[model samples]
Target chain A: MTALAPPRLPTILPLGLARGALELRRFFRSRETVVFTFALPTVLLVLLGSVFGDHAEAQGVTSSQVLAAGMIAAGIMSTTFVSLGTDIAGDRDDGTLKRLRGTPMPAAAYFIGKVVLVAVTTVAQIVVMLTVAVAMFDLSLPDTAGDWLTFAWVFALGVVGCSLLGIAISSLARTARSASAVTQLPYLALQFISGVFVNPITALPTGLVVTASFFPVKWMAQGFRSVFLPDSMAAYEPAGTWELDRVALVLGAWCVIGLVLCLTTFRWRRGQDG
Target chain B: MTDAAISVRGLRKRYRGSRRPAVDGVDLDVARGEVVALLGPNGAGKTTTVEILEGHRDRDDGEVAVLGTDPADGGRTWRARIGVVTQSATDLLELTPAEAVRHFARYYPDPRDPDEVLELVGLADAPRAVVKLSGGQRRRLDVALGIVGRPELLFLDEPTTGFDPQARRDFWRLVRALAAEGTTILLTTHYLEEAEVLADRLTVITDGVVVAEGSPATLAGRQSRPALVGWLEDGRPRTEATATPSALVAALGQHFGGEVPGLSVRRPSLEDVYLELLSAAAPEPALATAGGAR
Candidate 1:
């Protein structure tokens, strides 16, 4: 008798896209995820923007504008870091990851799907926060094509950096309950030191500013500020300039570090000690 | 393809920091299109062995081949040929059954129609939402996903653990239908009745070792054991274990000249032999043997 033919393997791109679309649908359907990812940032933007409306703090810009710019970076952190971290940890706890491991779908495809989800949600969060800033708080839109260019790269790099960090940190949470608690501590700390809450970036302690500069959050906030604020406003920045080159360098380094950490440390299943 | 869908020799696995291996020198062979049940109590290493074959868990030592490929190095092509129904239920709470099945179907090159697979698994008209499904219906959905790829081999780990009697029977029919379609099935279950009804061969494991292996009727020499001749005589119960139960019944018929009251010619069941095998394999064999004698 003739031998049977081998089974055909699926290509990664289409399968990963389908998986990503399914995860997006799930994200939108869940009320808790929607509330946390979208509503919380918008609410923070409005609340903080209204409380500090049009009160020029430094470099002739209102407090709301600085916070609005800073909130964009904070929003990316919320969606990519806090949201994705808990979701992955919960998937591990619920055996969803284990079920996927038994199938022919490549693990890289699974991660690609996760990255796609993060990219989509990051874009959505940025759009919502910026719309609210311009429409409700009188925050000016970026005028020059150069400003828009800065916004684009910063947004892309921030999403990639925070998403990789999220996947890497999610391995620390062994259960669904601990996942949120584990991620929230660093998320809150980053927001404070990155000057998302404070009026003037220089008002923060020198040591705290130095510490925040070591991470992506501070650079992301700085990138957004350069795009939203006028050129003269750069004098009030910690470096007394927009420092776009430094922003690129710091965020780029984080992207590489986060990717390496994820590849080396992520666990598909907990207690797989071997 | 090899004649055996699954073949293992001297399979061994020990969890880290544990004194004993989870699976110790176990051997198993399942022929194509045959249903084999690995019977054992909890912590008997049934799940460990099945996971090793599925390539989800690494085995410390042994030779294992599923569909002529070593599971340790099996790639996507080999994985596509086998399906696994894991013990824990998957949580796809947001997607409907149709959505979930169709999504997973894209991962396979050739798959059964999602609608038809749902029908085959007896969830044709069930609710759309996965979270809304009953426990049995949810399980049927799991089985649907497992077979949607039209796998040549299926591994089910306690497929009907929480199923009610009627639901369990329906699941058995589904398994039988899959087997009829030439799917080699290896199921692990602690229920002896389920094993007897579903498996063509039974392999009993205790303390990570295979103590007995045979057809359900013959495992542990069950068929050769003496039948118990029980009856009521003058309002008192009497029982006699003898090899020639029919002959004793004939004599009783001759004496009574009619039916023997409360008479039951009971032979050893699969459960009895399974218990005996487990007891013999237990660490405290003397205590178990004494318990089995009564």
Candidate 2:
């Protein structure tokens, strides 16, 4: 043979799409994961909104509307952070990661697939949360082009930041069985400290709010609240105004922090593997 | 430079906090297109050795090469040339066999048709979720995924662990076909019959070191070991172990004046050789001598 062609390596985009599609197919195929796991936040939103919807917070803003907006932010975290931390741990435990490692597929392709999975599922999750909020809790849809733009960026950044943090935290779990517990405690505590559940953001201690401000959840909840609630309701915030610039800065910073964490902490195979 | 598809020299690995090395010192080579079977008892470093060669794990001390490149530095192009069937079965729980095969097929530059692969593995009609498949079917699916890439070199670590008798037969047939097509295969199995049928050569490892390596017929000198000669002598039984069984049988028959009543000659079966090798190697990991391992 005179000259043979060089070996062709598999590209990332197509393989990533394939992996993403497979992940979605597997995720939706299991009715339990679809119903109990993904749908848990929506159910919680319904129960919380019903009890709090009657209490009015600010001008034309019922506590339920505020709660609905906050819950949407929490719902994104559920689909991204908690869900991925647990599911990726399961992937590690079940030999999925090792199987893929043996193939020519790049690790970045796996992350792309996860990002796709989170994006589609979260959009679906947000739609359900929004519909329930508008129909039952009287939460108004954003009427302005500016407000809708805010919604888009907030959703994108929240997804990216939380998903990377989720992937990072997954390695901290010793096993898949422990992942849910490990992620859930921080998830629930973040909800409280980030002002997702507590009303009038000022209800939480000032020092606690300052500490929660460093994380993305507080900024995410605060950002979503600005997009959904009336402008006059901004006065009720701890800062007395919707600090959209600060929200962007903090979430953007966490996105970088999350990426760094993932690079340092992600484990493809368990340490015990030999 | 050599003909080996896989080559390892004096490999060793010790997991942290363990008193003994997981893989003490092993040397192995599987030539291009050769189907080499590795046999060992549980926790005998078979998996650790295979994993090191597969580039799934690192060996603390070794010069390892798979397909002309050290597995530690194996890149995507290098990985494209090989396939691995792990010791543990990995199920894509919600995906059908067809879907899983198709998904994994995209990872190679050139992959077999997913449908053809499914049919080849006897999973053509596996319409149910992977979780619902029987143990044998799951193993077949693992083989299907491992082979869909049409790799030049394939490593199977305990590939038939859960297969039934017929499934094992079918798998042996597949291995034969693969070997016939010039695929280099390194197989680890407990079934001696399967190894005898599939492997061109056999390598037995124990206590993280190679105890024996040769063709299935001659491994551990199975072919040359003394044969047992038995006959009935005046209503009593007599037997002798000798290198010249035919000559001894002939003499016995002549001594009986016509025919040797109930005469039987037996050579060491592959199983017998394997058991003896394992027992001999089990004690004293230090007795595993290394000389021309290079």
Candidate 3:
């Protein structure tokens, strides 16, 4: 027998990135999935903003600009929560998870791959939303480095939290066919009460605003508005100021919660053996 | 036992809410560099046994040491030493065979070159997405991925289910080449011919237990089974079963005073031996009547 050296298992990070690259390639190849998933936020921005933009402008900010900012947050959630939930469910149904279980790749690497896939798709959503806002809605890019820094942190927390959440809920779907309903319903409901769908955060009932306050969607919307809308709109917020610190706290806490749920609920197999 | 690449003792698993254990008590071992074929009827615990050995499922009771490590707690290093090809692996959709193989190649420390692995599996030039490949091509792709890590032991579960005649023969050659390289293989297959062609020994399982285990030629005393002797006499056919067919044939030749007219002799084939074993080992009268699934 030839003396064979023990083969090395790749470290988590590079393997994770490689998995991430593969995920991105697969995600884009299904052209309809890309078009439909990406089109939702952009279409909402144009149609909703056009109908609501004209005189809804208050304190030097048009409704389109306000709506566009919040859409970036909603758009990120769409890509992270809904897209990932469906993607993971699809992976389970199509036997991706089973095959990966046999490989030397770690479970954390698989999560990292999903995160990477979400990060890329989320960035694409942000870019599309930003371009539309600039070209059509008269929304300007943040001028100061500090303002841009807020965008970065908010983007980071939002993506990580929602991606983790998507991973957690993906287990609830028994089949990929049902994943759409399992993912879409919760986030769709959150957007409405979180003030992404409904205009003027205070127009909703006090109880509804309080309920939305406990979730990440409201905080994410609040953070994005702080970046994209003028400073004066903070006065129009229910709290009469952008609670950026609380926004960071709530989103960060969700990231931890999401990770915990993922650790507890993920499954590699969906069917009976033998 | 020390030299065994895979060893199991009293392995048993019962699925929740099921009346019977899927694997009642399976004791199997594959020595280093040996090709062992597991043969059984459907729902006969063949998959259950292999899955337990692969560490893909938990056994209710038993001992399993795959590559000398308890599969239940086998770490990443242990996983790197083994290759598993299961029937349920249907992922890797958009990438071409080349792309998929190259990507999987990254996870191993000393994986075979992606191009060479692809070529060995006869998919070196498959340019379309994996989702577009035929069933046979996909099975070959599965083999390519299974061997990419240069694993010391390979567990193949129904690897040739969708393979055509040519593809099956080609795959048999591949298995032989891998065996010659000293890779211990424990393969589950329904094809008796496949077992005869590739396995050093054959194990026949039924209803979650092994009924017989031996080299292909001697399994269930196949070589010792009575052989049939036949000849034409006065334009009428005559036949008889004899433990010593050669002596019987020679006597018949003497009776004919020259080559006995249209004489023939035949021994029980592997399939006949296997069927007899299954019937003998059947736990119920109904199952014995049901016969072997093949």
Choose the strongest candidate by DockQ: 1
TM-score of chain B of 2: 0.89
Q: Runs in model 3 with CA error above 4 Å?
A: A1-7, A271-274, B228-265, B283-294
Task: Give the interface-residue alpha carbon RMSD of model 3.
Answer: 1.7
Which candidate gets the maximum TM-score versus the true structure?
1
Q: Which digits, one per residue and each the tens of the lDDT, describe model 1 over residues A145-259?
A: 9999999999989999999899988998878789999999999898899888885668999999999989998899999989998888888788889899999999999999999
Which regions in candidate 2 have their CA more than 4 angstroms from the true location? Answer: A1-7, B229-240, B246-264, B284-294
Please give the TM-score for the first chain of candidate 2: 0.96
Candidate 1 chain B: worst-modelled 10 consecutive residues by lDDT: B285-294
Q: What is the C-alpha lDDT of each candidate?
A: 0.88, 0.88, 0.88
Q: Could you give candidate 3's per-residue lDDT for residues A137-185 as a string of tens digits?
A: 8899999898899999999999999998998899999888899999999
Query: Which is superior by TM-score, 1 or 2?
Result: 1
- Tens digits of per-residue lDDT, candidate 1, B116-197, equal 9988987878757898998888888888888888899999999999889999999999999999999999999978999999
lDDT of 3 by residue, B1-294 (tens): 669898899988888988977788889988999999999999889988888888888989988998898988987787888888989567888899999999888888888889998888889889899999988889888888888988899989999997789989998988888899999999999999999999999988898998899999999888788998989999999989899999998899889999898898999889878877777777466764575462
Of candidates 2 and 1, the better by DockQ: 1
Which is the winner by DockQ between candidate 2 and candidate 3?
Answer: 2
For model 1 the TM-score comes to 0.94
How does model 3 fare in lDDT?
A: 0.88
